[model samples]
Target: MAKYEAKMKETESSVIEFIETVENPKKREDAYKLLEIFSEATGYEAKMWGPSIIGFGSYHYKYASGHEGDAPLVGFSPRKAKISLYFATGDTEREVILERFGKHTSAKACVYINKVADIDVEVLKELINRSIKFLQETYGS
Candidate 1:
């Protein structure tokens, strides 16, 4: 059987150059802040995922049906509307942190925020730590 794959694979693309292309100046600045935060929290050098996402660490995941692929443990994309924070989707601690995360919207796996200043940095750190821990526990580095 053919192996499963993810479209959002890591790339050698320059993250700085990608951030530089963000039309919004504030989003560009926030992208840099997120890069620093995710890098410091995960202790992983950032890499570009696909064309836009700035990913930190990565892990392999296989489902019961055997579909599997590598994915970033934590990452973010500075979109025009909001910053999409990629985190452990089902983590209860993540939900708790998000409650206090300050002015953000969340979906199944992505948290949307307008700016870093719109959220609490300490809570953001906690979320990043929790996501790294959860992902590492679920899928080893």
Candidate 2:
């Protein structure tokens, strides 16, 4: 069997350059704000994850099946339709916070918001911290 490789590994690509390419002015601006927020919250400089995601920190995980990969502890992508917030899944506190996270939609692994103003920044920070803690505890520092 071939060794598994993750496509979204960290890159030397410039995060600021990627954000500048976001055509939507509002989304671009929101991306900048998110960059600041995630940076402050994670205390890690942002890195470009794949082509789109602005990621902070990282962790390695291996499933029971032996699939292993590294992923950002917290990240986001300002897509054309919505901003995707990446956090640790299966976190009970995360679910509770999402209930009061203001206007947004969520998938199993991502929370989607139309813009920064649509959600509570304080709550967002809490989510970032929670995700980092959860990943660290589950996977290791």
Candidate 3:
């Protein structure tokens, strides 16, 4: 059987240069701030994942279907529409925090924010910590 693969793989692409390409000045600035936040929170240097995401730390995951690969413990993408904050989905605490996370929207895998000022930084830090802790406990560091 063919090997299963993860689409969002880490790469050697320059994270700073990629952030510099963000056309919106505000998004660019937010990207830098997020970079710092995730870095300090994860205690890991950021790396480019796929084409856009800035990821900190990594863990390998294997599923029952035999799909397995390495992925960032936590990450984010500063897209044109909004900033996508990556976290472990299905976390009850994450859900609870999002309810009070100021102005933001969330999906199964990410929380979207228009800007850093739109959400609470302390909550963001908590989300980051929770994500890293969850992934580490679930998949090891």
Q: Scored by CA lDDT, what does every candidate get?
A: 0.89, 0.93, 0.90
Please give the TM-score that candidate 1 achieves against the real structure: 0.94
Clashes of each: 0, 0, 0
The estimated TM-scores of all candidates read: 0.94, 0.97, 0.95
Clashing pairs in 1: none
Q: Name model 2 segments beyond 4 Å from true.
A: none
Per-residue lDDT of candidate 1, residues 9-83 (tens digit): 999999999999999998899999989888888898999999988998888887888788888888999998899
User: For this target, which candidate reaches the highest lDDT against the unseen true structure?
Assistant: 2
Superposed by TM-score, candidate 1 places the C-alpha of residue 34 at a distance from the truth, in angstroms, of 1.1
Ranking by lDDT: 2, 3, 1
lDDT of 2 by residue, 23-81 (tens): 99999999999999999999999999999898999999889998899889999999998
